[model samples]
Target: MSEQDLFADIRPYNDNEVAPAIQRLIADEEFIQAILHYRFPHMPGVIGSVAAPLLRFILKRKLAKLKSVQDVQRQVATFMNKMIETTSKEITFSGLELLDPKKSYLFLSNHRDIAMDPALVNWCLHQKGFATVRIAIGDNLLRKPCATELMKLNKSFIVKRGAKGPREMLKNFSQLSAYIKHSLDENHSVWIAQKEGRAKDGNDVTDPAILKMFYMQGKKQGTDFATYMAELNIVPVCLSYEYDPCDTDKIKELWQKKTVGHYQKSEFEDIDTIIKGIVGFKGRIHVAFSAPVTSIPAEPDDLAKLIDQQIWQNYRLFPINYLAAGIQDSSIDEVAVEQWQNRLMAVPDGAHDLLTQLYAAPVAKKQ
Candidate 1:
């Protein structure tokens, strides 16, 4: 098969595919209902049922103008600007001066929030006149057809996570690795989380498996691991949120995992989490970009440690972190302590220690 045909199942939608995708999104009853529920969270069930068709009409009219991927991104950027202005107190970024605008990079970033981590990274790059990236989103999150449509429209490619057999798993990973290499070859940047999922417990460790997957295509080509990795121009990115919007939910989930040994999610839990992440309040935020890795390591484990060091060192620790770590000093005042205590009041007493450990992990890692 041709390269285009090989990657057709995993790649983002092209310009010619945008119109049909938008039309499908508009016609999808699930998508329309999701929008209605998100926009009018407190509306009665009867009212929501009545409003679905009207919501579809409004979406059709609004989305009619988005003729291409660039147009869709422009529309998203407008909403993103508004979201940042309203939900965040401040957003600071650094290390953009170290990057060349003409070069393509693989941005391997610490994952914290489901939607906001990449969205914020893309926003920072866009503001600095850099081309936006093709984000790697896992298939586990795309349980709905509408979800897949929305993600593809936003330039996200799927990472197949549901392979049922060892051969299928290898095939999926090989295709993903090839796609990443192909994107870089085409002078397009890409963003992928350091691991498969968000660091829900606030521990941002790079999984070596992720690095191995990244090298799959190169290994098949008989290239040295270090040489292939250096060719990708991998950049380690650090994203720090002073207050995670989904902290409480994350704390609960972690608590369950610790106490019950497993935590189960509802049918629409991921969707709900995505909505909460977007509309929820986040305090001061920081996105730190490190210079691309030059001293490439031969082993995935060593490379993971290197990436972890950069993320841990560059991570911005807030006053809340210190308080959660039980470090009382000049940096953390009585008011901060009181506020943190009040926040803890809403959490279950049994899970209080887990919450503390969540925020304290980064502080400990940095130290």
Candidate 2:
């Protein structure tokens, strides 16, 4: 097979493949079962038994007509619209008008939620009349064959995190880097997390290794590091959630890792987190897009720090962050502290301080 075909299984669905991809998803019983569960979460046993087939029938009718990616996006928009209304008190954007809609950008963002970080960025871009971006999803989330298809159909390309050896890992990184460059060359925007995983501690730091990977493919083309980075039009995106849906889960994971030396995720845990992040209340959401970093430094470490500064500067703070930071220094207003204390009453005692630190870490870092 050709290079494109070799990476076909990992790439997003093309326009011609969209219809068949949707068909495959519809036929996947696991996918259908997941839809049934999400559609009728409150309905139990017998009701679920009846509702599953009914919901699947309705989905078949709806999905069968979705022949293009835009058609699928329209359907996705409905859920996103609902999510905004139900989860957020307000959803706002900044710095979007500074961008040229015709230009493709590499959006490097601080990852908070499993899915919503990039989804919110895509939503904002789509609303601004810009093309939505293809997302970078990890291989760990694609444990099931159908899971891979589902993500690809939704414009997610895989990053091979589970490569066995150093040689294979380097090749995967090269392919990933090349794919990102190719997408930009085709005038397609892309969304990738600033780091390999969510900064579980809420510190918006960029990993130098990720920056180095971006240079790998460009180096092969004999382009200078700074020039190659500038040509990609890298933009820093900051997504702030007033209330992270998976805050407690994240705290638990962090706590486990700290105490036990590592945290092991159960099967479907990531999927569960994704569902929670989508449906749970977020209070208020703000996404800030930084101007393209045209003057990148030659050193990966320096470039990483530059990205971190942009992300930290653009990150919007909510009331909870102030409350969290106040708990540390006692500088916050008494009235606001009291109000947040009452809110904290709802959180479990075990996770209270850790969760507070999670929100406060960003504020502290920003300072």
Candidate 3:
């Protein structure tokens, strides 16, 4: 098999196939049951029981027009814009003027809130007449009933993890590569994280292997893996949160990682975090769209390093990262990252929590 085939085997979003995909998600009883339990616990069971299927029946046929990916983009864009207009909530974005809807882009952003990282960016892109990018959802996330349905609706395809068979791994990666290429070739932008997983420490670092696999996927088709790399039009996106709504969850998870050497990964808990994060109050959010990186050379090592540096610039930081760093290291300047927090009328009470959670090394040294 050609290396290009490995990278380019991704199943493109087909209009004809969307209904079946939607049907599969809508009919998954576990999905319906979970959403009801989590989101509508107060409503009688009969409500979702009748509501889900009825809702499916009403919209299933309409998905035909959604066959054109552009149509889907417009619908999602319109829906997002309308939601924002009607809500009291607001998100101030900078650097979006840098984007070009006429060209396809590979948008790489930091992962903060489980759901909104991509949603917010897509919403902004939609406003600019750009198509919504296909998102990458971890295969582990499908284990949760509610998240599975939600992610698919938002143009996310799964990335399988821990496959035992060599064939399975190759097949999965090939398909992913193809999907990304097709998205760009079609003028639909792609959105992905820099690393295979979220940076729990909030220190944004890209894994070389992740970008390596990206180009390798299309090698099977005789596509100049180098050419594919060059065509990616990589864009750095930063999602800044004034305070992580789930800082407590992050701290608890880190505590587990340090003690157990590995934290359990599951989709249900992630779904819970996403739900709570969106509806929960966020003091401020900034989604910055940096210029695209169009210069990718063929050398694997060189290409990966180049991509890594670009993404690092966009890694969003919490105000507390500065505070934590300062309290831990008396030598460093505290006034740097904490400027935003200090300017506020009343900073979050959890600034102390952040210091304690993040500065374990210093605490141990003093002890």
- What CA root-mean-square deviation does each model show from the true structure? 1.3, 2.6, 6.8
Candidate 3 lDDT over 1-367, as tens digits, reads 8643454223334455555656676677776566567766888867777877765665566554565455766777676565545431456776778767788888877666667688888887766677678888787766655455456656786777867999988867767776777668877777888777655556555566667677875676667757767678878777766555665666667666665788885646867886676665555566888777667676767765666565555544443444554453343355435543443323234444442443222222222
Q: lDDT scores for all predictions? A: 0.91, 0.85, 0.63
lDDT, candidate 2, 1-367, per-residue tens: 6767866867898878888877787778788778777776666778777766776688788878888888777778888998899888899999998899999999999999879998999899989899899999999999877788778878999999988899999999999998898889889899999998887778778889988898888899999899888898999998988888787788888777767899999999989998899989887899999999977898989999998888888777876788788744444457556756765665567667777888888787777
Strongest candidate by TM-score: 1
Task: List TM-scores for all candidates, in order.
Answer: 0.97, 0.93, 0.72
lDDT of 1 at 136: 97
- The lDDT-based order of candidates, best leading, equals 1, 2, 3
Candidate 1 local accuracy as lDDT?
0.91
Task: Give the distance in Å from residue 89's predicted Cα in candidate 2 to where it truly belongs.
Answer: 0.5
Which of the two candidates, 2 or 3, achieves a greater lDDT against the reference?
Answer: 2
